[model samples]
Target: MRLGSREVGYPHLLAAALLVAMLVGVGVGAGTSSSTYGAFNAAWDGGSGIRGVASDAGAETQVVYNTTEYETVDPAGTVAFVISPERGYTDAEAARIESFVRAGGTVVVADDFRPHGNDLLARLGASARIDRTPLRDDRHQYRAGALPVATRVAADPLTRNVTRLTLNHPATVTANESTVLVRSSNFSYLDRDDDGELDDAETLQSYPVVTAERLGAGDVVVVSDPSVFINAMLDRPDNRAFAAALAADRQTVVLDFSHAEERPPLQVALRALRGSAGLQLLFGGLVVGAVALVARRGRLS
Candidate 1:
């Protein structure tokens, strides 16, 4: 027997209530998240974040989350801060970023504690490599495992007014085209075995952790560690000063978040197809025809 209007309406109401509750739960979870990384993620405070960088320099910051491509942004004259992306960029996106840098924009790529750093470096024409081994300096360490304290740093505007810099288990970097910005102490060694103790087999010498390269009218800065921008370390020594100098420009600062967008490739393709006006109208017509057929029966039998 066909159900009455009241009976069908009751199920609809129940479903609507359940959906509302689920949505509310999701909203609350999103508000409480305190992710240390990811573009435009403001849940973290001074804990692996660049919000301090934006505030100290008095620069307008725009987070790139929904924007699929870098070319969507106008990189006329500004700084692009890309820190510790979980994934590599698409070819189109990489080309756009390179063009932005070559056209007088500044780009800062900082990555450590991961394997994704070289994705952009390989395309940038710079042979600089981020060492996989952890750089350790016992004498100047902030903690075990050689969280080195940087005292012997390069003389540059970015390092100016910086007295103390306590690095995490930072990776080492090398490049012939770039100038070394931060260096390890001579006594430092790489923990090749993951053991805290320095082994004779491990390389014992200072290495570069940060470097900057100038291309065309732009500059590209690469740092071995991205945790230096975290909120917890920004106040340590002259880290805040260091971060402030990166944003010391008149143009806006953009934090690229597209890398962390976790959508699958198939879903991305579907969304692209849905963007077409013809497809939308075709789908709309089909929906209307389905509704008309259902109405002709006087109910969804």
Candidate 2:
């Protein structure tokens, strides 16, 4: 390559490409994740759409990679979402979340067939509990009974315009009837035996899929299925509307990924640098030094 009277080598072009790639990675927190419902995942089953929902509602979206950061969040103006955690929280970790809720922060726990979400709910002293069995509706569903369509939505602020919710492999929540926000139809039955057929012994009944309870000055909202918040499922207008309402009035909406199995590497590194003034200064010095050296070499040429 020729630049004015000077010639550029192939090595220089390769270096430029590498630098561009690195900047792109740093800009977007590039990394691959095998875990579902990860905040950074752009995949179909991921929860990345929730970030967009928060942004569209005029709220700041924050992805918290550590539960230790929970104490730093201002409970007065933050709404936290804990979705499909890969691992259970310790006593201390659960207590931190509980404190955040009790101090006037809202928390939404969306999970199914996992003990982790229920464990957190118990620690929060909330009466809501996600059942182990998968709820199926043969009458009211999108395609199959496994994917039930919940039309029994409560007329709450969060579900104001939401008419129906399409669920994927959801569970039922066992909570006080008054606290229920969404429920399965009367024809729906719990697949306790994992069999598609409803046996004569198992009677069809209405079960709660979403519930909420007041905790001190805050609120705890439980959704039996976490998949409802995923990217693919958000295509449903009602689902997207409900998610938008959750973040609508909040100043800051947080996606808690502390118990997640994986995270974007660049995000973690940037967050670490942001927390440390020394590291930021050192990184800045290196950048300035590299630019000065390059300028000196150009002048000599």
lDDT of 2 by residue, 186-247 (tens): 98999888898788767888899888899988899999989999999997748998898788
Model 2 / residue 61 / CA error / Å:
0.4
Best by TM-score: 2
- lDDT for 267 in candidate 2 is 78
Instruction: Evaluate model 2: give its lDDT.
Output: 0.87
Per residue, candidate 1 scores C-alpha lDDT tens digits across 1-301 of: 2265434667787898999999888665443334455432444332325655776677777655443444555565578878787778767777777888887777888887676668877776556768777888888777555678766677787677766567787888876778888787887888888888788798668888878888777788888878777766666666777777777853577877567634334334445566688878887899999999978777644
RMSD in Å for model 1: 6.5
Taken over the whole model, the C-alpha lDDT of each candidate is 0.71, 0.87
lDDT of 1 at 259: 74
